[model samples]
Target chain A: MMIPLESFHLAEPVLAYLDPGTGSIILQAVVGIVLGAVFAIRMFWSRICMTVSGIFGKGGMEKDGEDETEHSG
Target chain B: MRRSTPAERRLPSSFRDPSGFLFQRDGTLFRQVNEVYREDFQRLMRPDGLYDRLVSDRLLVRHEEAPKEFVDPELGFTVIAPERVPFISYPYEWSFSQLKDAALLTLQIQRLAMEHDMSLKDCSAYNIQFLEGRPVLIDTLSLERYEEGKPWVAYRQFCQHFLAPLALMSYQDVRLSQLLRVYIDGVPLDLASKLLPSRTKWKFSLLTHLHLHAGSQKRHADDAATGKSAKARDAKISKFRLTALVDNLQSTVRKLEWKPAGTEWGDYYADTNYDDQSMAKKQELVARLAAKAKPQSVWDLGANNGHFSRIAAEAAGVAAVAFDIDPVAVEKNYRQIQSDQRKDILPLVLDLTNPSPSLGWHHRERDSLAERGPADLVMGLALIHHLAISNNLPFDHLARFFHDVGKSVILEFVPKSDSQVRKLLATREDIFPDYHEEGFEASFGQWFEIEERISIEGSERTLYFLRRKD
Candidate 1:
């Protein structure tokens, strides 16, 4: 059974600049930057939540007390 | 200046990392840690306690500072000498359980990092190595000082590198895991999301990690301003949340499951065209041939679920390595061994046609599949047809390759008239005119002496035991 790579290629359909005929370095770089930004935003959104909570403190979206409890037993 | 010999230059686990390469000048193997990675390496070893804990737990390979005189000049980097691993395996070559264990270990390391205010910067499954039956994280520089509330920077990577392939294996089909061989970066999430059943959206982990994760990654991948730089994201996560994330991931990974059953070749021995009498005769012949080899170690190539591998294992308690291309078959075989506490047999995933290649820095660290073999005895039962028809390998070439791996071999031959061979020929052009018993015997005669041949009852296939004299 071949597992398909689904959403990783989602941008393939919408991009008008991804022409295979010409080696357009500028176009490719623009596309890359766009994709990279989206990846970065998703990664940092959780951090943004925590930063907002850090200012207020009482009910932060995340907790960071070093608990060392074995969760796998 | 005299240069190092290629054999001496070979270092284990070096080919996977491309930033710089690893090589050996003397007997000791060393990784020329490049300047590009200098800061990350220092942070991982110093301010972060990842190095110490990983060493203490035996989850990472230990290394020492090396003298300048023992370095390779061609590849520019400061060489830090390290201990070598006994053997190397690729992700596509790992059993389902093996891959699962490695994934858990990676998450465990990530969890461990939270306490020390560090995080795994990359989540490539290739970074993990198996040494002496244990999974050890090989990339020491992957850990970085954790930013508070950065929401696991390697999340999409972790999902791509581990979760997607695993989920596909569990849900769609186990063979899908082989996509790692082609993708190099792990299966893409968009592809996985499409292949998965619609019901997967209900599973929180799958939804969050696979579907929503892929969607978010796609939308924001272009928005560079959205991701906070290291200074901006420092809202320290309470240790409890860190632990919760780890626990949640562990539970999520554990819950994602698959059961192996009913593949064409999976339950082969039981449903084979052979009757009980023929099966017993064949088994007896195989035992006799393998016993004569007096092998200390054996490899059962194309060992579908390992029924014949057990026959060869009776050859004086030797270690038996059972290899199959099918993930489901390998998984089932491994699970059975684990449940039964079978110690002598090691089940692995392998595609005979396109085997594992040496990867990492300079291709020195991990040895390719062929570099690790040439067992005392290799059993290639019911495997010739696939190689002959499916792969279109000639008999002489197969014989020579087998000779390269082992001193003795046991092979099975199925005529063109046989149902199995006919099924294979049906799909493609039947250009193999010399793919019969006569051609097999003649080709193998150049390197081996036929010791015994047994015809499986209730079938047209024949099994041969041959000893390589060359």
Candidate 2:
């Protein structure tokens, strides 16, 4: 005998609440690391270059100072 | 709280924010703050001192509390009325510098909010509005208390709305900023990543924010499809790290600059046929006509750097909107407005051929250019030839459009014999047979009554002041 299909009650399925696109959050994490590293490098690169140049080329320091003043002015 | 009548209407665009929504009672606007947002509202108003700081800096719109009766009894905890902006403009209507300024202002507000133990819950460009010739944040409900180790919830929204559009405009074509009109929630990051040049991947900021970010989004989408959605909750960022991220984003924005140059209309005044006498005469005529009408608001179409618009504004003491097709021209106009501390003129980029249309939910959130008007007066100086000859728009069509958008128009008609008209004819075939002064008069005469006409002193152009027929 074939059973009737209308007798059962199905519970409502719970849907996940995603306020922002799931893709957006994942992407942010990957980008944050890269952004931090790049910022650190950019912040220190000029100072490091200046220090190394100063140590290696002591006689050229006066010329560099003049150039810096000219550029700044 | 006072009882609201049946006339109380809520704005559709303001419905999404659960904290509060803007409603109109009679003709005045009011914002109803719900009980759910009481704590945050108190933080913004009281202990934090954020409201006072932002208001004093003029970074945020100012508002005053209304009686409790003004609120809806069910959903409302408090009611407040904000100062009305003269005209509400959308992101798509803004020029490059205007969008950039809005972006910077959002970041500055975010930084300020962090200091007050709060963070912006949303970073939608729609929250910002131009007031008193400057951009100011209008949403009081956009802030929430900051948690110690939660990722900035608005990061993605900020990137899509401000960073993506700014980057695209700076690196690629300026017109690409129009993508904001199509994507009301801001341009999709994946699309932005793909549209950007491959070399942009080598630039640290673009590499991290756009290209790699797009890749991660794809991966997350794939994971979500397989029912792995819980991963989003697992990813947490410290508050210090969040501040650093914001700082980096600010620096990226600061570095991405577009110097508006090389556009056709940018150097228009330099090569114009007008001599000093003719220019002065034109200015005098415009001022006299404007004074006669005494319009409260004026729109200067094709206002290249706002030379004549200023005459109307100053003479009539009216608020003027200076619109141009060229970004460079609008930029120059805005820079002058800033430096001069002028409160009357607001410059925006607009191509008349395809002006900004109504967009967002049900096409009602942002108003179309036509809906914002019938301005008191519209000045179309040296603009007809380009629309009529260059764009192949008939005189009748131009007349109808102008009549519909403004109560009165001051139109400058450039005859076929004019050098400017000759220049336009040099490039294209002379298809406009009825582009002469008589055809112009006959077509516009149907919709308007010609009040006065004057021949400019050293040019073939004749300026006509027409008032729309009832």
Candidate 3:
């Protein structure tokens, strides 16, 4: 899943922040965890399942042709 | 197969991953949030009062949730349409105070996120926009739950995006803020580090925020791609510490103040070529012409301190865009606007010779100055002489350019006989022999119909009201 982020068209003012310089790390970690978990789960689980489903549905004949070509070669 | 429509012609903002792109449907604005963002979206809306609090505080835009159906085939997310902002301005377009306000607003939002055990992953200024003179954060999904001790991931981005440019503008030159236009992902820290003076290293905030920050960035630059993601997950920051950090940033930013210095045309009225009566007559003539035009919107092309812009604004109740090449003049005009709380005028720094052009991805993202539009009426007071004599642009070209910008033009012609034009001509070639009244009328007549001409009592300058023909 994606995190909502704002995009500014032009440059922003260089005013001070409400948070200290050091405290930004905590926020970054929280964001990293949420985004990381979602991406990992999708790539490893749903992606494999989708590939397996596609093979069973349409690619079985293609797989047999490939195996025949390999044996002939 | 579903047939496609013209509504899907434009692309959304290309920076972030999980969040969908912003698109316009039938002139209404909407954002598409992917299923990838669903978990974070749920967390932001579920427990911490983050969404409601920000919306109630006016820190966020209030929106009606969009339906689940897909408008396009490629994207995984559906639309979550939001309210449209009236006029969007860029950082380069903002006055010093406007930018300062935006920075402070971003920090405020970040702090609130921390209080709710959420944190902002990215601190790009583009995510923030001004609504009715106040800065508001637009990117709702940028906030995620804070993890312990992994180091601020968006730290370098914050410094580059907000701190670097601000420091450069504050310490080096105010005009340096334009550097943001060239650096899309904010000014590069290495470049910012180089441009800043040696003395900046001595300042504590500048040292930690810019110099040392640059050093750390350089060291970890490549490591960011492969570094331990899980290490970041285990660390957490306290709420009180976050507030303290906010206080530190506020104080640091507050300390970085810039004093406006005088520039050419900033003190123009005070050091004019005209005597008091002549000045009064000029003002009277300008006011009369402005009233006659009856413009709903006026652009004072070379508005020096906005003296005539005020006349048009006050007389016609028109919204005026007062533009000048001089930041000093624009700064002074901004101060005036702030003092009076005048909602009708916007003063901007613009070099007429080389106006802002279309910049960013595919040269289509941020529009050029001309692309913004043709003002209803345009004024070229004391500007033609500079363009004609100094810049060497022909009177015909000048007239043609003005014709394209405004339907009606109230232009001031300073004759070759005039001291200012003479002084300009004395310095160089007077190829503009057609720079006289006869020549002006002849060249301009091709594009415009001369409506009226009034001469100021004690000055040689003449103001002409011309409506574009054809």
Candidate 4:
């Protein structure tokens, strides 16, 4: 499981002054933990899940719903 | 605090970021890096550093270290001169695509910063500028060294500044982009959440980043109000997670698209009243006037896909701003600029009746259009009737506005006999009895000297070139 930022510790202090917002920090921390755990599980268990699901006649790993886009031509 | 020398004047918008402030000395802009920003500034300026990489990728503005004498002896750590954009445009003034592109650019920079072991200290729409038809980050001091287990500091600002406005524009009315003018720090997420359609909540990205995000802000409002920084500050989001967060935002911005169609003036020229001879003649007349005017900059008020502004742009090495009321028309102009690879023209969405005003702290954070220019020339073709007849504006009001924003104007006066004017009057009673050529000359002549007047060959419309009176 990914560590939530609230409980995560940093050795260095951030130099910027703008508030990152208390709610935003907590929400993103939750999101980050979920996404990281999902990616980790997918990476580690892809083959096992794919084979097991295939044997059961179910769908395997779905494609990552991401496409690359360029900023400047 | 180090005092500005007699020659150095600090720009108002430059005061927010404390790493440095942009000031002008002898009309040339320079960023004065404070002593506290020495390490980050050095890292950026070092060879093969983040600055070099970003500049090479055209993600950020390139700058040169100013002469030693240019640096202030007191508070200035050092000074660097950044390359100037032809024109600076605000997020409120941007087209849907332009704003979307800027959002993507900010995310792109953030991802790249992660790879470089740095983070954007702030994410603001004002920091991004449209340069040569592309959005580039102009603030060189925005990057800070990324600390392990530290969350992205600009996440809230990013959502507010880009995602909120974009979502409202796409899911609601495009004119809702005007909300950027009211909320200068980007649209409030709670407000955005309320205004957005219920259908948008079905979208996973919007649901998390916007709806839930606003809810989170509410949940933590009291904590923030009580100054409970210890709890949030101690919370550490790992670098990997932050990277994932940025990646998701990038995908979200990409998926949010606004197609330019169905707007009133999007396809305006397709069914214009001007026939081939009259259109060509009008073009010739504008070209002749522009050539004689020889302005370095032009503002094409009511510029429809920039057909007339192109004359002035081609005649002189001019930086032209094309202002139109229709978002689709401005989008078409922007897309054309991209496809054509033209750099001189900037297309923006603006309502002439309610132009952008002074905003932010002291009403100086963002400039009004008139404050930004007194453009060398203003080309207002086939636009008088809309302002005069449709909007019920008087000739003197039009003249004074033009005088305030430009040194000269190329105005076209369409007679009441014109079909477009007749169509406008058909809906309402013709209360504008003074809407005649003689009255136009008389009211405008109070502020401007009529330099030239030519009637189109095939139509009854008259074109006048007037220079502002000294």
Top candidate (TM-score): 4
Which CAPRI category fits model 1?
incorrect
Q: On a 0 to 100 scale, what is the lDDT of residue B103 in model 3? A: 71
Model 3: per-residue Cα lDDT at residue B291: 83
The first chain of model 1 has a TM-score of: 0.30
Q: State the lDDT of candidate 2 residue by residue for A1-73, as single tens digits.
A: 7652322424222121115567666666656666656656655775676787778875443222111001000
Q: Roughly what TM-score does model 1 have, to 2 decimal places? A: 0.67
- For this target, which candidate reaches the highest DockQ against the unseen true structure? 4
Q: List the candidates' TM-scores in order.
A: 0.67, 0.86, 0.75, 0.91
lDDT at position B217, candidate 2: 75
Position B12, candidate 2: lDDT: 65
For residues B150-267, write the lDDT of model 2, one tens digit per residue: 5677877888899899889888878888899999988898999988888888888788777777777777776766777676756766665666678777777777777655544345
The C-alpha stretches of model 3 lying farther than 4 A from their native spots are: A1-73, B1-4, B7-18, B38-70, B73-87, B116-118, B128-153, B224-236, B260-269, B273-297, B314-318
TM-score of the A chain in candidate 2: the value is 0.37
* Model 3 local distance difference test score: 0.69
lDDT (Cα, 0-100) at B115 in candidate 2: 85
Model 4 over residues B46-100: C-alpha lDDT tens digits? 6787888899988899998887553456666888899998788999999988998
TM-score of chain B of each: 0.74, 0.93, 0.83, 0.96
Q: Which regions in candidate 2 have their CA more than 4 angstroms from the true location?
A: A1-18, A29-73, B1-6, B69-72, B225-227, B260-269
* Candidate 1 lDDT, B214-299, residue by residue in tens: 67556544434545322222323344454555555666677666666655534544566567887787788788878878887788
